[model samples]
Target: MNLLEAEKFPFQQTRFTRTSDIQTIIKLFSQFSKEELMKKNQEVSIAGRMTGKRMFFADLTDQSETIQLKFSSENKKFAELDNGDIIGVVRGIVCRTDTQEKKNERKLSVEVEEFSLLSKCLRPIPSSYYGLSDTEERFRNRPLDFIVNKQKKEIFFLRHQVIKNIRQFLEEKKFIEIETPILVSEASGAQAKPFITHHNKLHRDFYLRIATEIPLKKLLVGGFEKIYEIGRIFRNEGIDARHNPEFTTIEVYQAYENAEYMMNLTEELFHYLAEKVFEKEKFTFNSHNISLQKPFRRLSMIEAIKEHINIDFAKINGLEEACQLAQKFNLKLEKFQKTVGHVILAFFEKFVEKNLIQPTFIYDYPVEVSPLAKSKPENEEIADRFELYIGGLEFANGYSELNDPTEQKKRFEEQSKQKELGNEEIASFDKEFLEALEYGMPPAGGLGIGIDRLIMLLTGQNSIKEVIAFPQLKNKEKNFE
Candidate 1:
């Protein structure tokens, strides 16, 4: 019978006492000379999977580095060992490979006095020398990918460091981290389609939050300032190298702050990560060598369009003129995009967005595109909004929030009209949010950053899958290839 099919495997051990891990052993004794190691002759107990050809010599690896294992001679028990067998404990004296030492090699080995099998790997695990090359297969079977690719494991470590540092930085500034409901009655924060599900007990449908902006702002009205949330967001959207249906985002709100203050804070937070967390000044992202050391460029959207192309948006005074310009450029406008503000956005996206290769702040958006943002006092046509772009990708968005209940109601009404006019991604008319606005919220700044995209930029990864451990992929036939 197969070993796993037996009532109990005769070779398996229940437990063992491990004195240290392979990483600790490598770090502590790698610098010692062969003679120095022999002088100490320290005894240790370690457990790991057997990884090489098992005969008189083999390798043992844990979560960290691998170590060599040596026996006096080939025996019946040693010959039965195969790669991927989990050893319970190899209790032995730590010493150098005194007889088979190689030039410039310092990895110590365990002179095994005794060991037992903890478990047997019934499935075959590929060699660590060559990891899984098929991208789809690697993503589908993440455990195997992690087993063979050391760098793949390192990416998650870097991701953890990024989140940990962010929390530490905000905590130092007295910013409180809060969590909002994932299943919301209505999704109104962002302009995206939401995933819907029925709540059996409530007998009503709920939406997986597309953005955490709404509930977090509600907390601001309930007498909390300088709050933020780092949580998962779901969207019923298309997938690409940059997008996943399920992802992470962080939304921050600060009462008594304006758009300019939030912009400065965004820049400082990035600089802190580069200097304090990673300690690196330069990064290569989207084939561009971008640096975090320099100050970011700031330009208005209309100005960017002007800089990229010779078209002067300031000259287009009316909707008729904007329509004529759109016809000249062959720009197609949707049913809801019939206004001058929409035309301005169409022109900016077509001519300006892809040219922003470095870190830039594009500010002063039109009111039609920014409903939650406050309109400028001097010019009601423009909203006090800004977005951060690096490598032609949007990383952060921030604006001075609209605190007027009456104006907010008007905006939602406009959104309702648009929803009827073929805009499927319009924010719902959230009456509760409007009521919260009536309760008198302070003038504040709200900012949101996509955590996965930010990780991709910082890690120099082009595809979103490299940063995310398990991303959504197309369903394979029957089983994953």
Candidate 2:
């Protein structure tokens, strides 16, 4: 039947006075003896969707638990009810049944006195006996997937708990949650191409934020000592098992702290999440076990490259020498990737990143790649930046934020030069951000963590899409035929 016809059907809309959930009822049944149950004979009511049916017996399930319902063959209303139908049973008595083949096994059931069909299932649901096997179909029809697989539903619940724990952890540390704009004239945050849109009323173009870094740091300059924003960031980038074009991030900034402080904070937060949320100090992701115990391994970017590739970047002096070494390794370089720092970063990405299976912090990044990070005091080429890698994925990026206006302007100029050299990922100089820095900002540290990746790691999910409820997918063109 059509939807309108189904709506017109005389389905009961009365409220059910359910005494307990299926689990609670089962617990109570186990507590009371069979003779005591019969003596008390307390009437119960419950409502849920019909999940299974076999002749006169049916299984009804709320999202939490499932209970059995037995119907008399003579009841016409019971005959009309089918699997996948919304049902409400009233004045039911708890009972136990034993099969002749399995006399030792007793099953709990509810003998129904009256029942109502709240909604009709006109279409047949996919067989729960067989399961939803197609991955694409499962993603497309997520609600049906949830119905068929309880584990899938629980993953989302776990995701919610993880986020809640993160919020609580940050709040306990006295970090203020703040919001920043999603659209702006310049997307000067991270090194990624932005999704641009025209603002009709203003008659100008605005880019969706690729990162929350710039604005949050500006708030730091505005005298908010500890601030954080958990928001969605958009980037026009390639999609992979780990990367999404649009994803959620938690960016935090604290004044009077350096990269070391952020690192320690990150370690503490992860340990807290593992203990409080998962109730463990370690968890396995994609067959690789990871520990959240204190003191994650720390390695400088150059040191990691040296360990993995056996090429000491510290000894390499000039751009020509770096390019020759990269060429010898057969690493591909873009047009703008000619500098020594760029080559070092390329080597790290190609040789070092995937091998970092344990929780490790690779710090001291090239200054050219980290425009907003402060340079190391002794060495001008390396920035006080670090990236947290676990399960062969980069989960977090943080740095000692650069507050020097003169040096910041010079760095922006260098980024502009790179943009002119055909690097689309290089951010344009944000005048407003520079002006804010000119107003005398404090020494600070900033960190950005990809929420989706973290969730995937903690939940043991292999892909970012698995953690995200509605991830971006390619458009399916309809076939007229």
Misplaced by over 4 Å in model 1 are 1-16, 98-106, 478-481
For candidate 2, what is the TM-score? Answer: 0.92
Question: What's the TM-score of each model vs. the native?
Answer: 0.94, 0.92
Question: Tens-digit lDDT track for model 1 on 12-31?
Answer: 55767899998888888888
Clash pairs, candidate 2, are: none
Residue 82 error for model 2, in Å? Answer: 2.9
Reference-based lDDT, each prediction: 0.87, 0.86
lDDT score, candidate 1, position 187: 84
Q: Candidate 2 residues 3-31, lDDT tens each?
A: 34443353546565677788788877866
**Weakest lDDT window of 10 consecutive positions for candidate 1:** 1-10
Distance from true location, Cα of 236 in model 2, Å: 1.8
lDDT, model 2: 0.86
The local lDDT score (0 to 100) that residue 211 gets in candidate 1 is 91
